[model samples]
Structure formats: structure tokens, C-alpha cells
Target: MADLHVESTVQDNTDHSPQNNEDVQKCHVVVPTTGMKFESEDEIYSFYNNYAYQMGFGVRISSKRKKPHKTYYALGCHKRGVYESKAESSKQSKSCKTDCPAKISVIVDYDGTCAISCVSLEHNHALSPKKSRFQRSHKKIDSYSKRRLELNDSAGIPLAKIFHSLVVEAEGYENLAFGERDCRNYIAKARQLRLGKGDAEALRDYFVRMQKRSTNFFYVIDMDDEGRLKNVFWADARSRAAYQLFGDVVFFDSTYLTNKYNMPFAPFVGVNHHGQFMLFGCGLVSREDTETYVWLLKSWLECMDGHAPKAIITYQCRAIQGAVAHVFPDSLHRLCLWHIMKKVPEKLGKLNQYKAIKKTLKSLVYESIQSQEFEDGWSQMIKEYALDKNDWLCSLFDDRKRWVPLYVKVIFWAGMSTTQRSEGMNAFFDDYVNSKTSLRQFVEQYDNALKSKKEKETKADFDSLNASYKLMTGFHFEKQFQASYTNAMFKLVQIELQCMLFCNHSLLKTHGTISTFNVTDILRGKRGELKRKVVYTVSFDEVGRDIQCSCHLFEFRGIICRHMMKILIEKDVKEIPSCYILSRWRKDLKHRHYHVINCYEDLKSGGHAKQFEQLCSSFYEVAHIANSQEKYDYLLKCIALAKEKLSDDSSWSVNTNTNTISQDAHIVSEPKKPLLPPAQVRSKGHPPTKRKESKIEQVTKKKRKINVHEANGISSVNDNIYRRSYDFDLNH
Candidate 1:
């Protein structure tokens, strides 16, 4: 059924308004062009469309195509039909058309210009309200508006702001011929169109390329019954390496909606040597259940070469807990304290002493460092608060070993306290995904986000390699740590060093090679109230040169505790033990750079075949000659010199006017690298205006980050997961 696009009112054909008077008189026909016509079909279309609008009519494409004749390109338009009311006339309502013979046709001349050849300006029936009287003029979002909206979306403009901007651009809401819902729906449809299956294919292709470039780039996709993508798991080379080194303790959190697909994005995170959160792997699950969780956990383990982390942390989820127990029975599973305490007010809000109970519960979680201490504290707090009958408190007590800090203090976490690292993971990719983001948009967004993160890591690496923070303390241990740890870790150790100032240590009894010392901490609070005192027993093994402290800070957090530092100072130890340093956080730890290169997927690429042949020839020759370590070293030096010479060579050196060979020497430039150029993403929509190969765009490739075309599928719970492996070759 034909429908009206917008509101319209009938007018008498005899009316003499300024516009009507002009139309009734000899109508001025603005020709497309008489001499130098437009070359673009869109331009020709635009000219006619504007002409129709001025005549209080709407225009639509009739038939615009090309042929091999003199009129190489032909463009045409016709008057748009209207939706007539039933009350006006039965024939008009049934037909919903005036049968107006108002149309145009343009022919492209041999000069690459278009000239209009046919025009019928007169209409059989009275024209309806300007533009809106047409059957499909309601959603006429111009190219300019779409591009503007796209730019705004990519810039992370809030949707509300985008609406305000579009409305203002149109001058007013009435000019838009649409409400906020229409604009939003248009944006949604646009995004879906651009970010649909092409994006999903793009994501798959990207990971395939990443895996080809590096050895440890791991990814797996589970397909549904129809071979559609169900669940996906992936981890990059650096992440795998990080897992190999620092995956002793892990934090798991993936219960948030990042994309429109409703798939949970779980990130396997751990604490690095420098106390920074390191991502080990990530998974996108269509559903969060025990079987799915199991697959994800097993996939993570597989990527890290079946090496399970000694401990795992997660929120209070029965599915996750069951998965962990089944998959990693040997590894201790801990619960996130943050998630537990967050529900405290809601769980215990009915009590009059809820505030007191909350405070006491927090103190119990943080203060107790031993099983005995925790037990004592829990019993005392519950009794005092009259919570012996509280089911929530009893359940918490029963599950204390999994969540209470005191129970898990002995296990190494590299200083991580909760699964909040997963929250940080969410923040890392939040900028990329929106409520309407599609799978393909996710891929582009994740790539950009990951690149930004790696760039920051590189900057940190530069600081660690070239810069140093000044030492605030003269402690010899501080000097050792500053030399070994990264700048960030050294700063943490420095804080620990400063805290030693308030610590008082005394020697206790010595048993053979083991010497014991008692260290007391006395701290003053902001209100001049002395905080709770803590005394720690430090044990030093003279034979092994190993040190241990009752606080177990090093064992858990990876940093030497204040008590141990005080003891060392008292004993006048010259250096920290070598065993205390972890390599993952070292200043010289090697990391790989993951670069995205343009992979010519088709046979039509320019000059790439020759480049590939040359690369293979050069690498093969080098590998063949450099058989032994000595020969390899010599080749390495030669390669270094070649690189240095290339970096130093200038194309246009300053022409010195000095005598003969020139006595004065010019300053050399910084080191330069031979980097490969990035590939351009295939784009959609209007034919590009620029001549250059479509370069990097804000929304890469075909973009919408769209709201529709969601890939929905489910993997079976009982399906056996086989190990998917790839082979590498020493030769190219």
C-alpha cells in the first residue's frame, strides 16, 4: 500500500501564492547545463532533484545507466508518486498517483559532460506540499548528513549530542522531516549495513594474518550446525609470552555486554612483574555457562602450552567455580573480594548495625593475614554483631577459604587483590564497542585499541630502557631494585623503602644458619590517631642467603615487604637476594611488536610479487651462510653495519662550500627503520573521490559498527574440544 511520507494539506488549483503564481506563469526551466555540463551522474541527479523541489515536487531515479553509444552514460528521473486520501476520491485513493508526466533525461556528451535532453515541467495534477507529499520522502538522509553522522560516531560523540548536532545542522527539527527515533533508526541501519558479514570476515582474516606473522598468535573459532561462527577465543604473541612468564596468578571477569550481540567478552588477566595488569587471553561467548566456561578456560590453557596458572581469581559464579574445579583441580580458585563486598549493603541492609557490620567485614577481609587470625576475627565479629543466625554471614564463613585474603595470602598473586583487572580490560576496549557495534566493527575497534595499548607499553619500555626515577632512599636494597626492576616497579619498591623508616627491628634467637628478627610498625593517621600496630617476624637463612617474613608480602605480591627491608637494614645487608627478582618485569625483558600489514589477498596487487621474492632470497642466503654461532655473529654485525649505513645515508646532504673534501662535518640523523606500509581496507558506498588507494579511515573497511546483522549461534555443551594446532617452518 502506498503511504504518505509526511503531513500534507490539499490546496485549490486557483490559489495565487507567490510560489503558485510563479508556477502558473511561464515557469523558468533551469537547464542542467548548456555548455560545460557536469561529469558526475550524482551532480546531474542533484540538479534535477533541486529543480523538482523548487517546483514543489519530489524526484526519484527512473533509469540511470551506461551504454557504448554516443550517449555513453544516460541519467534520468521522474516525478515521485503521492498517497491520495480516500475521502478525496475513490479512484485517486485506489491508484494513489496523479499520473503526472514530469520527468527528465540527461545524456553524456563525448566531452565527458552531461547535458539534459528531455524535460516535462508541467504536471497534470496540483503539486502536493514541498517534497513531503511523496510516498517515500520521509527518510531522505543526504550523503552530507550520513558522512557527518559517521564522523561524529567515530569521534565517540554521545548519541544525544549527535542528535542535537544533526538537528542544528538542519536548522530545526521540522526541516529534518523526522524525529529522534528516525535519526537513531537510520544510524542503526547504516551501521549494520557497513559492519555486517564483511566485518566478521575482516576479523577472521585479521587473526589469520596475525597468526601468520608470529608464532604465539593463537586463535580458535567454534562453528554452529550451519557452519556459522559460534564462539571465538584468541590471544596474541605478547600475551602468550606474558602468560608463560607471569601466569602464576590470574584474574577472570567477562560478565559485561560490550557488543550488540550480547556475547560476554571475558579477559584472562594477570599481574606482570612491574605490578601492571597483563592480558593473557580473551574469549567471546554467546552464553555464560559451566560448559562454555570450561571451553574458555581450557582454550586459555592450550594457548599457554597447557601450563595452568597456580591460582585463578573470579567473581562469585557457580558456573565458573565448577569449570575451574573440573579443568584445573590442582590450581586454587579464589573469589574476587570486590564482587563479594559490593553486595554487602544490599544483603545486610535490614540490620540497624549494617554500617558497623560492613566496616567490621572489610576489616576482617584486609586485616587478617593468617588462618588463626581470620578465624578469630570472624568468630568475634559475628558474635558481637549477633550474626550467628545470619545465613549470608554463615555462607560467607563457609566460603572464606576462597575469598578471604588471609586464606589465600600464601599463594602468589603478584599483588593483585581482585578480578578488577577484568574491569580494566573492559576499559581498554570500551572506546571501540557501542550498544550497536557489530562483529566487524568490534574487530577494527579492538585492533585500534590494542595498538594504542601496545604503543603505551612501548613508551614505558623506552622509559625503562633509557630513563630512571631518582632514588629517595640510600638503602642498598633500593639501589639493587632500581638497577633490576622497571621504573614503575622501582617506584613501588621505593614506597616500601620509605615505609621502613617507621619500622623498628630487633634481633631474636638464632638457630644455626637461620637468624630471626622482630619488626614493629608504628604509623600515625591523619587525625593524629595511631593506627593499628603490626609486628612481623623476619627469618634470614645465612647458608642459603634466602629471607622470609611473617607478612608474606613477597610471597603474595612479589615485592619485598617493609618488615624484611627493616631487618636487612639492621643486619647491614649489602644487596638483595638474586632469588627475589622476577625476570618478567626486568628492564631487559624482550617483547614482540605486532604490526598490521596490508596483505594483498588477490592476484592483482602491484609489485608485491617481486618484493616477496627478494625478501625470500635475501633471508635464505643469510640463513644458509650463517650456520655456526661465530658465523651468525659475523653476519649479524654485517647486517647491523648495513642498517646503520642505510640510516646514516642522506639523499640530499648540504652542499658545503668548504675546501676540497670539506673539513666541517654535518650532524647525523636519528636511526631509521625499514617499516612496511600498512594495507588499505576495502570500502563501500559512493565511488571514492580521492585517487590514492583508499587509506585508513576512522571506521575502517565497510563500517557501521552497525546495530543489526548480529551473528547469533550457540556451541553445544557436550561437544568434545580437540586441540587445534598449526605448524611453522624455519624457511620462508
Candidate 2:
């Protein structure tokens, strides 16, 4: 057996002449050891055609030639002629086989070389050209069908499935919409045909393409001309999602983003117990405009799945009030007391009158007075101001019926009467939202800030709960049980004790000290009246342990006043009863942990310093004036004593006449000339008899000048003196 080899090379320009052919042809031949036979040209042609077709090659076989024992064949052409050929030999010698007759075969080509050869036939199978008749038609169908059935990558998840999945993963998707991961998974799954990668490099390239596409779309949709995202409207899906997660009680407010009055931007906020204002929307409006307020309220309600809120608190803006009334009719609308207080002075026309009004308003809010008492106080306020009765003020007082009792219990005791809670939340948010954030990023930051605030508030609420419990049960019972008194009776006694401590401490303390003094003989018998007087006046009730005192320290401090302490000792309450200790009364004295003013350095260092300095200067001047009055009083007393000494001395007198005179002479020098009869004076006489003048009067009279500084302690040049003469003389 032998194997067959067939090889041919073809070239362009088919001409038989080798000179004209820059073409080459190569050939391979095969020989068979066993006798080989072609049998017929038809078979050779069939085999050549089959081989050419199977190998996907062009072939032309030349005519096959047969001899007595061998055959030659040429295959393929170059230069329009067969230049390549193969020869085979078929032979058998007598010594080679016994059964078969010996035969020798030789095949020769154009070169006439002969050898024994066997054709070794190996069959190669491949797809035939006839089989591809339907390929083009099938390909056309595939391309057209693929186009008709084009599946959107975004559609693969089915909106329902995407929504459901997001809802599940995000726990209702509260306020979350699609982010990078969501978008990536959606693109990958829905666009499997387009985006699938056959290799790692292809996968990386696909991801880069997707990122570019997503970025372009996100940028166009979110950002404005300045490349800053318009953080105004929340996506509809997100708004609904948040409504599903959080029920009503969503508090909303707004803050300015820029200082520009013209380009006003307000970021609307919603707050929770965590003190976080989850920014849900934004708008453009002035502070005084109500249009934004109305829109915000409507949008917020729509966001909350159309659920009505239980309450709303905001600053005292008339526009806001009108908007709120229009939008949330059922909600309990309240004014932020801080804002109300701030605006009160403006309403009253001057800041000078605010203090008095503020005090009165505060008392009205917090005090548990009867309706009549409230009315009387209100009337008195109007009278004091000489103002006509205002309907709004009356309405305010009547509105107290809605929330007063509860507010009085909680807010009054806490010293909070305002929705300052919202302001605090706003302050927290102002620090959180910055210029760089997109709406999506802002939402995420808000959620995180809220979580932190919730943790802190939870801890505080727990501590307050525990304290309240201890105050009500633990401490309350301990004091009652220790005193071997029934709880109700013990509480009654405690109230009386507290009242006495608050009202009368000094008298009780003095009485107790006096009683001890008599027992120890600390007081002498001469002081016995004082001791007895004090003892009789300051005795603690033997049955109830009530103490009567005049110091009123007990009424003021509410602690076990020193007087109460003495009474407690006298009653053999050796160990101080906790009942006498009012924890709340001592709260002011206790160390405070919370910051009084905000912890912001700007507020403390700048605004607060100016106010504190002004207050200090005012109090200093008042103290100086008060001290000056005390010194003036003592000086006045000394001046009075000096004036008394000047009146008592005789040498201090001044002589009025030219002749020297003693103090008695100066008093008696003035002469009485004459006296009329009482009967004549009663008759109203027209004229009287002339009298002779004294010779001393007829002599030249000297006009004397007296020094006024010597008489009245005032320095002056001269004083005129005139003497009176009582002479009843009638001139003819």
C-alpha cells in the first residue's frame, strides 16, 4: 500500500510559454509498491474535483494517461497550460509474491523518470459549496430579525422588577433613586448582547463606554449653566418613596442659599426628631413672599402621598400664615415664640416697651391662672398701655384653649415656649449642605446627619426617662417609707414643710437657737426675756413638724431652709429627710452639662460680648449713684451740727450802729417813740399832736455801712442799715 500526494500552484496570466510567465508551478508525485490502477479517467476526474472542493481550492486536472503497467497525471495549470504532473509505477516481481503473478509497473512524467509507486489515498471531507446556497438567505433573515427584535438594555429589568428590587434593597427606597450601582446593573443585564465581553479587556472597555454615557446624561439633566445641580425639585419617584417610609409630622422650612437679594434661593427643609432637616425641595422667593411658601406646602403634601400633617410650627410671617391656612387647614398651626418675641417690639412701636410686654406674655403662656384671673390680667394690661381692646389679642388668649394645658405642663417647665427647635435644626443643616453637592449627594448627607442626631437624641431621651422614673418612684417612696408615714400623709407633710421653708426660716432658726440656749444655759438670766420671747414665737409644730418663721428664706430657696433644718432637728429628724430636698429647686445650683448659648464661637465672641459689656456698664453706674447717696446723707448731718453751734454763740453777733455794741445792745438799740391811746385809736383820729425830736437826732447823723459777709457768712462789699423810729407826730 502507498500514499497519494497531489500539489499544484497557480498564477495569474495564463500563457503556455514559460518566458511570458513570470509564473511558477510546482508538482508532487506518488508511487505505490502494490499494483495501482486508475481504472478510468472518469474516476480520476471525480476524485480531483472532490479533493479540490473539500479543501476550498481552485483546481484543473489535465487528461490522465495510462500505459501497460503505469499511469501519469498532471494537475493545475500555469500560463494556460499544465506545467505540473505526477507519475506512478505499479510492478510485481516473481520473487515478491507467489499467489499473485509478478508484475512491474513504471510511471514517468515529462522527465521520463520511472519508479515503482503506489497511490496512497487519504480522503478529506469539508462542507460543499452547494450546501451554502441557503446561507445568504439565512443571514439576511438573522440581521433583519435582530433589528426588529432589538431589546433595550434599560428595559431588561422591567420597570416593575426594577422598582420592586430597589424597594426591597433600600428598605422602601425612602428617598433613594437610581445611583451608579443601580444604573450599572441595569445596563449590564438589559444590554447583554451589546455589552457582553468575550474577554477581560473587552469588559473594561465596555464599562468605560457606559461610564461616559451615564456621565453625559446625568450632567445634562442635573446641572444648570454654572455646572451646579439645581437642587430644587425632588424626583417624583423619590418623593413617593420617602412618603412611604416616613409618615406625616414632616416639618418643613426654608433658608437662603445666597446673600443676593435679587437671586434669592430658598432650600425647603423637612425635619424629624433627629434634628435633621431632610431637604426635600428648593425654590426662589424673597423672605416676605408667600408664593414659595404655598408651593412648598403643596409640594410637601404631595410628596407625603397626600397625607395631612398633625401640626406645623413656623416663624410669625403673615404671608406664611396665609399660605399655611390655605394648604393645611386641619393642622394645628403654631407661631415660633422666639420669632414672635423678636417681632413683638416692632408691633409695639419701640424696644423700650418690649420688656414689660414680654414678661406679661410669658406669664400668660405659662401661668395656671383661672379664666377670670387671666381676663383680669389681660384687662389690666390693656389699661396700663391705654390701648383699645384688640381682637387678635383676644383670639390669642382664646387659642390657648387648644394647646395651653399640655404646653403649660411640658414647655413651661422646660423654659421653652418657641419652635427654636426648627432654628437649631436649620443651623445644623446650614453646615451640612455646601456648594459642591448635587441633589442626590445632599439627600445622602442629610440621611447620615440625621442618623447621627438620632443616636444622640435617643441617649438623651433615655436619660430623661430614667431620671423621671427615679424622681417619681425611687426617691419618692424612699422618703415616705423611712419616715414610717403613709405616702399620701407624708406628701402632705412635705408640702407644708416646703411652704414653711420657703416662707419663714429666720423666726424658726431664732426660736430653735433660743430653746437650745435655755437648755444649755447659754443665755444669761438677764437675757431670759429675749430667750423666752424667741422660744414662744418660733416653735415647730409637734404633730406636723411645721415651722413658723419671718426670714422668708424657706419661701424663696425652697430647700430645707436653715429654719426648717432647726425644726427638723427639734423633731428628731436626725437624718435629713430627702422629702425636704427639692431636686428641681436646686437645679439652678447644679452643674450644667449642656451649653447655654450655642457652641458657635462667632456668636459667643462677637455678638454676646457686646451685649454683656453693655449690661455690666449699666449696672456699674447704678451702683456708683447708690453709694454716692449714702455719703451725702452723712455729710448733711455734720453741716446741721455746725449751724447749731453758730446760733448758740453770743460773740458771733454783729453790731449794726456806728457805736460799738454788745449782742444785747444790738437787740435793744431800736427805740419806741410813742404809743396812741387805745380809745383814740379806736375812734380813727385824723391827726395827732406833734412831738419834740431828740438832740442826738438833730446832730449830723453818720450813715453806717455794715459788712454782709460777717452777718451771713457770705462775702460782699457793704450793706445798708435803716433804723425804725416809732414816733406818732403830725406836721402842720
Candidate 3:
């Protein structure tokens, strides 16, 4: 992106007086120019600065031409680097800023007489309005407004909003001399000054302050041989506690590169009860390698008191895998499902099953419920698709036990399968961090991200501790889950409970205490949905009041699957068996000592909270009054809908209709609209078209198209395809 707008440098009034001013000249060497005589260089420079301001620009003190015993001083536009060749000087200045002929000269003469001259006065760019031109030339924000902006910035306000607020505070748009861009530039300079040079000392200074603020706050920083940062890791006390509660399954991935340094921003994320991404720790490393990974993992493990996660999921990389295996030998290092599926297209492009492979792989990984079933299906796929010879796929199969859902069905992962949470964390920090974000800026941004995530977790914790979630289904077993599970876990359980009603089951086998049922979904699979046909074997220890299903949902997903729930209902098992109630899926995790992080970032977070509440209270009164009027009803409704639509621009839709608001849960009997065709065809704009490529098509090296003509091709004057032959070539 090119910078379209150009500006000239402006300086503030200087204190030194003009050298040729008669205030110091001993009454004889009179001033030659028609400007006010001043005593010192500061006074002379001040006159030039004022002249530059009036001309919509600024001037700087140019170096005086000095000989062996001669001295001369001049003031000119800093953009115009003064030289003997005026053309070259002008060209150099205009190259940086086209059409900006900002040049002025104030020279001290040989007789100690001052001469003021305007060499170049015209400006190509439009001048700022009078109200702001002077202040902008000086680049000074009034002390009060600067303080206000700093206060709001510290409050974590958005930059654009803060600018708008300053505009509002000015009472008039033109009252403020500087633009938003200037305000941003000033803020950047202020932050740079506050952080000092970005180095080990600066980082240590920040960490020391953090430790003083929160005794439990800890950090580990690794430095390179040149005393520069190689890797740094940190975690707060509450975050550590959350890890203790729900860190059994951890997700690791380099979430973003929102810094000038281009550090790998890897965050260790976990799933809270509300299915929100929880930050356990964050690491910024100079590079991705086995050594860096080892150092980061060690720091994280040390912070967690050597309590390793039961499972860790990350994108497949040899360096990360080796480090994980070396450091966390007992923990299951799994492959991210998203990464595996993403790599399939590029890695297996040569295979014949390129088109059907996606569907087959999804079924083989997500649908298959047993290890033996996956083994058989995988082998069959390799044979049918001729994928057995592919080295990449062969390596994947060799490590299937680590990534395939079927093989790890017995381990409890709390339903986490990839660094999708980490990706979301990256997005969460997008509002805070940017390409030019520095170390101090990143710390501030990290606080903002952490605060938002903690707020969500706090909200969920509050709901679990206080509010009662409405039950979607009216069932005793469902109600039991509603009470026992957190809102998020209960939602999953409620979905399974609803699914149990749709399952059509028939007893297939009964031998001793083992019973098998062939469960077929009646409402789904027969239509447009994916087919789900399976036999669920239920082992019932009637004497111990225990039951288990083959789907292993209770064992792995930490939720009772519909298959098992149907069997449990058949067996008249009343409340969820105590053994299946996973505490990790609930807010009430059984940690030795768990602490929830405070949601409010600081005491000043509520600076405008009470004021906003008062406004909301006033609106409530107006809403009540408007509700009584039929005319105001739609208007009030519109306001609410507008608020919702404006609150989240990403999800709100302008085209949402009545059909979209209703659900398919209850069968609504309505007359179907008569089928009609082409009453109104699509507008005659360019019709949508897809460029279909062959299944084997992959991006290869660019090739030029060869146009080989026959040996004796005739060329017509009108035939542009053939070149004209001046003479007979074959005879020669």
C-alpha cells in the first residue's frame, strides 16, 4: 500500500534569539532585512517557525556554510536538503513528496545583518483548515487531551473509538488540531518511550512489575548468545489453577505472527466447561525447532509444578513430535485432525481416490467407533484406492494409533481434537496485536486477550454457580444431567438424550450378562443425512449396577452416547451412573485447590459501567411506555433488533426471515407452497461458473504453450496466426 497523503515537517518555536538582531548588536551594524531585530538565535528561529506555520509548513535550522574563518547561518524547509545545485535539492525533496516545494531561507549576512527570504512558498497539497493548521504544524496535543487519551488507552479502549471520543470531547470536530493518524503516531511514540528499547532489560523491567502486581505471576525468558530473546514463556496463577482443573487435554499451536519480530506465538489452550478456549500458558519463540520446543515445554511444565497433561494435540512436525516425546514420554502426543485433513490434498494428490478420499477418510476417522473397525476400513481403503504404495500415507498409517479417533477412544480428551482452540485464540488476539506490535504492546495485548477469555470463563462459572439453565428436553434422565453437568456439558447431554428417542433399536444377541442391540436411526440417514448403522454391545454388571457400551462415548468423550443411553433406559438405570459423571466437563472440577481468575481487568474497568447502566435504566422506562402503544411496538422491536444486529456484525444477517427463526424440533403442519419454475429468473448479470479441474490436477511449474506449425505452412496476409515468409525457404 502506498501512502497517498503527504505532510511537511513542522517545528515548535525555539528559545534562542537571532544572531544579527540589534538587541545584542552594538548599535552600528544595522539589520538589513525588514524583520524584527532579536537578541539570540532562538528569537531568529522563532520568527522563521512562525513564517512556516503561516505558509502551512514547518522549517528547520539548516547547516550554515562555513569557510576557514567565515560563518553563515540559514533556516529552510527540512525537506529541502540544501545543496549548491538547487535542481538536485528540489528533485530530492519532491521525490519524497511530489509537488511539495516547501522552501524558505533566513540567512545571516557578512555585516551581521539578518536577511529573511521566501524562496519557495507554494504547496501542492491542500492546506489543513485554519483551526488545526497551526497546531498540526506544531504537532502538539494540549496537555489535557493528551492525558485523556492516555487514560482511555490504559483502559484498553479501541484506537478509533478513543479518537472519536476525543473528537466528542472537543465539542467540535475542528477544535482538535491533530487528526486521528497524528493521535495514533503520538500514542506509538509514547508507548515506545514507556517501554524504552525492546531488550532483556526492558522485558525484565516489565516482568518485575508484573510480579509486584501479582505475586503468583511468573515468567521464564530464554536469551540467545547475543543477549537477545530466543524464547519466553509465562502463566498466571489462576491460569495454572485452571490447567490443574481442565488441562488433561491440552491444545498447542503457533496461533499468530502479529509482531515486527515475527516470533512464533504458540499458546497452550484448554477447553473450559462452557467449551470456551482457556489459556494455560503462552510462548513466543524466535524459531520453531526441537531445542526451542523443548525449552518452552520445560518452562510450561515447571510452571504447572511438573503436572503433565494426559494428552497434547498439535500440528504434525518432526521437531515438535521429537521434543514432546522426549519431554513428555508418558503423555499421549496426538495429531491435530484439522492439520491432517488439510495436509491430505497436497500429500496424496497422486492417489486415484482423490475425490472420494475426503468422505472415506472422514468416515474412517470420525464415524468408526472401534479400533478393529478402523483397521479393517483403513486396510480396505489402502487396497481399493491403491494408496498402499504412497510413502506419506504409509507413514500416517504407521502413526494411526496417535491420531485416529478410534484408537484413542478409550482416553478422555474432553472432546478436544486439535489446535482449533489455538486458532481461535489467535483470532482473539487480533483485536489487540498487529504487525508493528512491539514487546510492550504485545504484553498489553496479551492482558486484553487474557481478560476477555477470563471474562467468558467467569461468566460460565457464574452461570454454573448461580443461574439454572433451561432444559431443552423434558425427561427425568435429562433433568438429572441438567443439574449435574455444566451448561455446556448439559447441552451436549440434552442433544444425546433427544437422539435416544430417534434411535430404533432391536435386541440382536443376549448371552449371559452381555446383550447386543442393532440400533438404526429412523429419522436420519434414510433422507439426505449421512448413514449411521451400528450394533452397540452393552455389558451389564447387574449385580454392581454398572453398564458400558461399545461406542465408548462415556469412556472417551466423557458423555453418554445415544446408543448407551438407550440401553441404560431399557435397563431402567435411573440417574447417570456416578462413575460416568466427569467433573472436568463441569465447572465444579475436583482440583486440590482451584482459583478462578478475576474478570475485571482493573478497578477502572467500571469507569463508565455505572453511567451506561443509568442510560440502560432510562431506556427501560421508555421501553415500558412504548410497549403500551401499538405504533411504538414495532419501533421498539426495531431498536432491539438493530442493537442485536449491531452488537455482532459477523453473525447478524439482514436477510433472516420467519423460516430462519423457527426450529425443526416440532412438526408444524402447514400447506406447502405450489412448486413454480422461472417466475422470476436470476438477473442477467454474469452467471456463477466454476472452473473444474481434473482430479489429478495439482499446481506444477509454469509451462509455455508450444505452437508447432507444419514444415510448409502457407501464410495469408489476414491470417495473423502464421508469420509472413519474405522468400522461399525450402529451396535454400
The lDDT for every candidate, in the order shown, is 0.64, 0.38, 0.63
lDDT of 3 by residue, 164-225 (tens): 98888778666776788888887777666655555445556667666766777779977655
Looking at candidate 2, what is the lDDT of residue 535? 21
Higher-scoring candidate on TM-score, 1 or 2: 1
**What are the per-residue Cα lDDT tens digits for candidate 1 across 92-170?**
4244455555666677765666766765545665544444424343347675566566656554455678889888877
Q: Which candidate leads in lDDT? A: 1
Residue 56 lDDT, candidate 1, scale 0-100: 55
C-alpha lDDT (0 to 100) for residue 119 of candidate 1? 50
Q: Once model 1 is optimally superposed onto the true structure by TM-score, how far is the C-alpha of residue 322 displaced, in angstroms? A: 1.8
Q: How far is candidate 1 from the true structure (C-alpha RMSD, Å)?
A: 18.7
lDDT of 1 at 40: 62
In terms of TM-score, the best-performing candidate is 3
Predictions: Cα RMSD each: 18.7, 50.9, 21.2
Question: Candidate order by lDDT, highest to lowest?
Answer: 1, 3, 2
TM-score, predicted candidate 2 vs. hidden true structure: 0.29
Q: Report the alpha-carbon TM-score of model 3 versus the true structure.
A: 0.65
lDDT of 1 at 58: 59
Better of 1 and 3 by TM-score: 3
